[model samples]
Structures are given as structure tokens and as C-alpha cells.
Target: MAETRVKSFVLRFLLAQPLTYWKLLKYIDVDIPTVQKTLKNLLRNKILEYKNNLFYLTSKGREEAKDLGISVFNSAMCPECHGKTVTLSPFKWLVKEFESLTFERPKAISEYDQGYVDSTDTVARVIFMYQLGDIEGKNIILLGDDDLTSLALLASGFPKQVTVLEIDQRILNFIEKKAALKGWNNLEVIRYDVREPLPDQFKGKYDVFLTDPVETIGGLRLFLSRCVEALKGEGSIGYFGLTHLEASRQKWWNIQKDILEMGFTITDIVRGFHTYLLERDDILNLELKVVKEAPVEIKIPEVDFYTSNLFRIYAVNSPQPLVRGKVDWQRELYYDQEAYVTCP
Candidate 1:
């Protein structure tokens, strides 16, 4: 059972050292209730004890884990990033490649268009896809590439073809220029909106699709539906980012249901995988407005704080096709008052 396996993993980690509930939630991608239930069960069985704001395995828990063997921790490893938010070894090459590329940073568009994560995270995203065997001669499409992930993917010299569909003309043009300069002939860009049905020629043409979608139910559904339309049948994989800061558990459940109903099975979720920088021009000013009381001068954030967990879903059956035609980009798809706050 998934629940049993999760509890065992937590026990194994406790064998090494006590962990706070917050760290467990932030690093482990399992549902909150599931984690809580597992902790409760372990406590009830006298296999775990809590003290000093940490959870530790009791003597019985240690004995049970010994019976299970130390190797059990292996299964607990995050399938997406391969380790628990641990940066990959040999990652410097990816970082170097990312740093070499240059582009102008655009102002965040009133919470309608979320800003991209730093280049390192963009490169890391591509690397994770590659590590999962989703690259090399596969047709990959980015439903949205505000992060310029396509560049990193192409720079890695994997994937037979890479396509980017973006609504922002500025991003489209920038990608086009950089691609040409790099002589990435296999890379292509088109000005397209996710609210619109996927172009006929693009449908059922990709082995993988990647995006960081708007978190609302309608928004996530529309974006994911378009990506599913563009994927080749079973075994096709899609990757995207979702965050707890914006999406509640109920919203996640609805989105997961939509994915399964459309014929996908979520394979892996790496929590806090993508980190976004909060530059003054990007999000610092916007975030300051949302607080109840505004300070005269807000100091810049030292750390890159905003983050989203990565989800990898595989097409378990033929992708359900939606009617092919233009669909209006309703305000509900991009703007939900509950999900966003912007200064007038």
C-alpha cells in the first residue's frame, strides 16, 4: 500500500535523525493528510515519539525498520529528481550552459503571467526530464516557456525536436533569436495561446510536454488538456509545476482527477524543485502590496524564495482528444480573485 510505504520511509528517515513536521511536508511530496495519518499510526503503535518539536522512531520502530532492512529507503527516493530535493551531481555543467545564455528580464504582468524561475532551475528541469529517459530523439513541446526551458533543453543536445508555444511575443522573439545564434535548427517557436485548441499539425506529435501552468482549476485544466492533445499516445509524459502557496489540497484533488480522467497517471512529484528569484522589478514590489500593512521601504529578499513542486504524469492510455478549434481565453482561466492579489 502507498500509505504503508510512505510511513516506512518516514520511519527510516527517523532512524537517521529526528525531523520536524514542516521539513517532512516541504521535502516529501506525499499528501498532507497521508503524512499526518502515517505519523499518527506510528505513534499509536508506540513506534514513534514526539518531543522537542521533532518526531523520532521509538525502540519498536527501530526494530521494525531493522526487520525491513536499510535498503527500504531506496524506494522512498523521489523518482522525478532522483533524490529528495537534493541537487544532482555533475550539475555544474548544466549551470554553466544556462549562464552562457542571455536574455532581458521582463516585468511580471500583474500576477496574470507568473515570472520564470532562475536559469539554474530551468536547466535543472530539463536535466530531470533527460534523466527520466524522456529525451533523445523524442519530440518535446513546452506548452509555455516563460522560463526559457526550451533553450536549456536544446543546449543539452538531447531531443530530436523541441517546440515552444508561448503567448508572449517578447518571449517568442527572444527564444527565436537565441535559437538561431546557437544554430539549434531542430528548435521551433510559434506565437500561440494555451486557451486556444492545439493546432491540428501539432496534435499527437510529441513524446513529452512541459509547462508551469496557472494554479486555478479551470486554468490548470485548460493548459494540461492542450498538452495532452499535443502528446503522442500511451507512454507520453508531461511535466508541470504546482505550489501549495497558491493551490489548496481541494484544488490539487480536482486537478489530479482531471488528469486521471483524461488518461494520465501521476508518476512522480518532486517538492520545491523549482525556485524563483524575487527581484525588485519581478515580484518584490508585487508581494509587498499583498501584505496587510505596507512598510515605507521594504528590503530586498536575500534568498530566492518562491517555489513550486514538479509533477511528472504519464499517459497510461490513448490521450482523450478534445474538439479542435479556437477557444476563448476566459478571464476565469487566468484570473481568480482568491488565487491572486495585485495592487491597483
Candidate 2:
């Protein structure tokens, strides 16, 4: 469904204008058969309506076209659709992915999301992987993300192999079926506990690694140590740090200092924020820590939003442009790949 991101554009275009199938076929560079088939499916589902050889959305379809994801878009900025209204989706929406979990009917999506907690630190850690030195075709091991494990793997568009290490057999078994449902091929899930230790086959065998192990300060260092041990000589690592549980930000700072001691250089430390919160929380100010002494530059293009919240980290084990000085992705901060000396 996510193939090429073409569907969204196609659907949105068609909904905005009522044109005949033939006209649309010739106007859009898409396959006629594909467009026709999609039209039929959407029409049948009342997602669209057509008459007089021209297409138009039914009332239900019109409502569906108005859907948007929760983001930092300021309604005030968009003079067209701006309002502080809440009604558990008092109006029905055409899109339905959040399903029983969309929180449309919750106390406050933004606030509840802010107040609601993620038991596992899955999404946070995966976002950190992109900032690592070219995560492309790298092997990944996610300890326990449940459904989130798969989404993160695909979103990266990199990583040669992603091994989901889980503690529960039932969840691990369930992931197989879930992967099939999603039609993802490059991801694999492993049932294992971080408490034991990474197996011999995993030692020093990966380029980059990430994990959102069960949160508890007592065992966190141990979990991170295993992640670092798995990386190559200069490989980097990233993970989520849930700050709500603790009053002190020492865990985040101490870990950065300790990781550098072990040899991994620290780069970007993106802050974490609520995807959907119960009330208005400053998304920008949410980023409460120094995520990076300098930005990390990878061969791939990237987008990072979590750098706007409570302290979380994305540190690396190598020395180069990261330690020498400030980083600018479009321009080199240093010439030598091995040293972080200031560039002319």
C-alpha cells in the first residue's frame, strides 16, 4: 500500500476534481487499469462516487478527504482549517488506521498521548538509527517492540537485516502473522532476553544496533553494554530514554559520558515527544537536552522530529566530523574522516 507514495496523491487529486475516468487516465501518468480498478474499489466502498461519467465524492467521501495526521501544523498558520475543537471525532472520518486506538474518543488525544505512556521504547530508538553512520544494509536487533518493531524497520528504508529480539514467545509468534499481514519481507523476529546476554553469533557482527529494552535504571547499562558489544569497531548505537519515570536527567547525561569512555562518539541526541497528547504541550520546548555536540551526517537523506522533546539520545562509537566541531549535513565540517579537527 505504501508503494511509491503515489496512492495518496492519486486519491487526493481525484477527490478534488470530478473528471471522467478516461480524462483522468490520460491526465495522470498512472496505469489506466490501475486507476480504473482503484476507482471501482473506492466507489464500491463509498469512498468515492461517480455520475454522468464524472467523479464526485459522496458526503462520506468528502469527509474522508479531509483527514490529516497529528502533527506540528499550526491551524492558525493554515487560515483554511484552524480551530480548537474536540468531539471524539463527533464526526465520522473516512480514514481508519488508529482504529480502536485512534483515541478520537479519548479524554484528549494530544494530552492523553502526553499522559499515556509507551511501556516499550520502540519508536524512539529506531529513529536514532538513521542518524548513525549510514545505517544502510546494516543488521538491527530490536529487543521488544511488538507491533512497532515492524513499522520502524520499514520506515528506515535501510538496514540489511532487522532481527527483533523479544522476551515473549507468544508475541514473537504473533509477529510472524503480523508481518505476513503487512507483506514485509526483510524483517525477522527473535525470541530472546537481554538479561542473559547476546549470543556468540551476535558479538561484533553488526554495524549499527538499537533496542528499547524494558525500562528500569538497574538493568539499563547492562542492556546498552550488550548493544555496544555487538557493534563493529566503530559502529554506533541508539535507544529511547523514557524521562517521565525519573525526576533526574542524569541517566541520559551519564550514559553519553560513559559511552564515549567506551569509544563511541556522541552525535545527535533527539528529544522525544508525544505523538498524540492529552493537552497543549510545547513540542519545541519538549526537547530539553543537548542531543548532539554536533549533528551526524550519513550518506542518506533524513528527517528528524523527536529532537523536540524530553531528553533521549542517539550516540555513536566512532570519532570524526562528530567530535571535531559543529556539523552541517550539506557541507563538510572536516575533511579527514578519522579526525574531528576544525576545517578551513
Q: What TM-score, computed on C-alpha atoms, does each candidate reach?
A: 0.71, 0.44
lDDT values of the candidates? 0.73, 0.42
The runs of at least 3 residues in candidate 1 whose Cα sits more than 4 Å from the true structure, single-residue gaps closed, are 1-87, 103-111, 281-290, 293-302, 321-324, 341-344
Superposed Cα deviation of residue 266, candidate 1 (Å):
0.5
lDDT of 2 by residue, 89-159 (tens): 32222113223222232232221112322312233334334434445777766555443444445544567
For candidate 2, give the lDDT of residue 302. 19
Count of clashes in candidate 1: 0
Best candidate (score: TM-score): 1
lDDT of 1: 0.73
Candidate 2 global lDDT: 0.42
Per-prediction CA RMSD (Å): 7.8, 20.9
